[model samples]
Target: MNKFIVVTGGTKGIGLAILQKFAQQGFDVATCSRSQKDLDTLKSELEKQHSCNVIVVKADMSKRNDIKVFSDAVIKLNRPVDVLVNNAGYFAQGQICTEPEGTLENTMEANVYSAYYMTRELVSLMKKNKKGHIFNMCSVASIKAYPSGASYGISKFALLGFSKVLREELKKYGIRVTAVMPGATRTASWEKSDLPEDRFMKSEDIADLVYASHALSDKSVVEEIVIRPQLGDI
Candidate 1:
């Protein structure tokens, strides 16, 4: 069977870059996002460009029900997943004391709970097959404290913690887990900033690293990957 990958929030940014990269390498891919229109468009473009089967689903990862909805669709595929990239996430700038109420809650629902619940559903297939890789899209905020980075930082830190625990738990099963901490990526999240584009890392750069990490022989795995802009964090 062809290699299969599932990347969440593939409508744009690093997720989109990942989808394009893997599709070009002949991996049949699946992805989900909040917007059906965008998903449909991505499906068409990747299918046309790479001629690989593309599965698209409309899913708001922040919601548990939607995570199941997307997971069920993948389970129904009846094929073992070769890779899973938990890329869907939320980001907002705020101070813990002054940030809007529920900021931490909402961000956790997106960046942490979604991956937790989604991974719960799919790891079984990997266990059955005895091989798979999972990538959690963490952030530099996970390790550094910055002004106005409250909720997003907390959520990413929790995500990194989750990834570490998962790495330990799944190691015996031959399922590799990687926590990806990226800094100042030039995605929609940074579009509002006035900083020069060169200051941030390209989404494709992360994508390349993610795919490369998975391409290693099954005997080895990269536990964590930290990427930053050439000029450093913005």
Candidate 2:
């Protein structure tokens, strides 16, 4: 049985980069996206390009039912899950004071609840063998407050805190959990930004760190990683 990795929201951005990186290393990948078309395309591309199993499921991570749908897809594979990236998230820039009602609730549902539900379903699989690594895609917003970024920042902060508690609980199980807090990265999310492409880090930069962290010795686990653009937050 080949070791496999699972990633959510893996059709684009940092999630896509991480999926490709793992596939390149000969790991079978199971990932999810909301777009069935994108998932099919990604499955074909990765299988053809990397010569590995590419299981792509259509899932809306914010919903527990949908998370179960994705989890069932992966669990049926019956492969050892070596790494799981809870990368599905939503980003909306809005001030806490003036933002519409349920702004924070919506953001938290996507960024925090989604990861929580997905992990609850999959961690048991990892626990079965007492092995695996889990990465939560946090943000620099988790540690710093910025204007018009309240919902995102608050959700990210809660996510980081969740990762911390998960790490503590899973330590004895030999399942490592890491919080990845990255600064601005060039992705579709920033298509409208006026900043130069060089101003923000590339998705691959964050992907590289994720791969490296998982490659470390089983006895050595990175608890948290914070990376930023050279010029700093934009």
Candidate 3:
């Protein structure tokens, strides 16, 4: 049986690249996004391009119910989840003191709560199987505070801490957990930017790192990965 991998926000950017990488490697890929049309389009394209199974669900990862529904859909596949990538997140820009009241809370909900709820819903299966890999998409702001980063940075810091704790907790269960922190990766988030593409790392670079981490022996786990462009943060 082909291994199964679930990725959140799989319609575009790094998430889409990861899905493509794993699908090319023959892993049955399942993913979710907020847009039904995007899901449908991605499903059609991936199924046509890759021989492996492609499962797409229209789900808003920030909602607990949506996360539950998404997890249930994957569990119904009856295939043990070999990997879960928590890659759904949004970027918010503002100074900590100047941002609107709900900005911080909403950012936390989108970036932190989404990953937490999704992992909580799916981790039991990994524990039951005594095997699995989980990747949490963090950011360079996770470690270094940047001006105007505000809520997004706070959310990523929380996510990185969560990933670290999960790694320690799941070590006994033979599950691997990794926090992926990338600096200035080119994605949809930067579509309006005037900077050249070379100023940022490609999403495929992150995907390749993810595949490499998973390719390692079960006994050797990469707890965290920090990828940056050779030109440095932009």
Tens-digit lDDT track for model 2 on 1-234? 567999999999999999999999888999998899999999999989997988989989888889999999988877778999999997898998899999998889889999998899889989998999999999998899987788999999999999999999999999999999999999888888999877899999899999999999999999999999999989
77-186: candidate 3 lDDT, tens digit per residue:
87799999999999978998898899988999889999998898889999999999999999999999987789999999999999999999999999999999999988
Backbone clashes in model 3, listed as residue pairs: none
Which candidate model has the greater lDDT, 1 or 2?
1
TM-score versus the correct structure, for each prediction:
0.99, 0.98, 0.98
lDDT, model 3: 0.93
Kindly report which residue pairs in candidate 2 clash with one another.
none
Misplaced by over 4 Å in model 2 are none
Candidate 3 TM-score to native: 0.98
Give the lDDT of residue 198 in candidate 3.
85
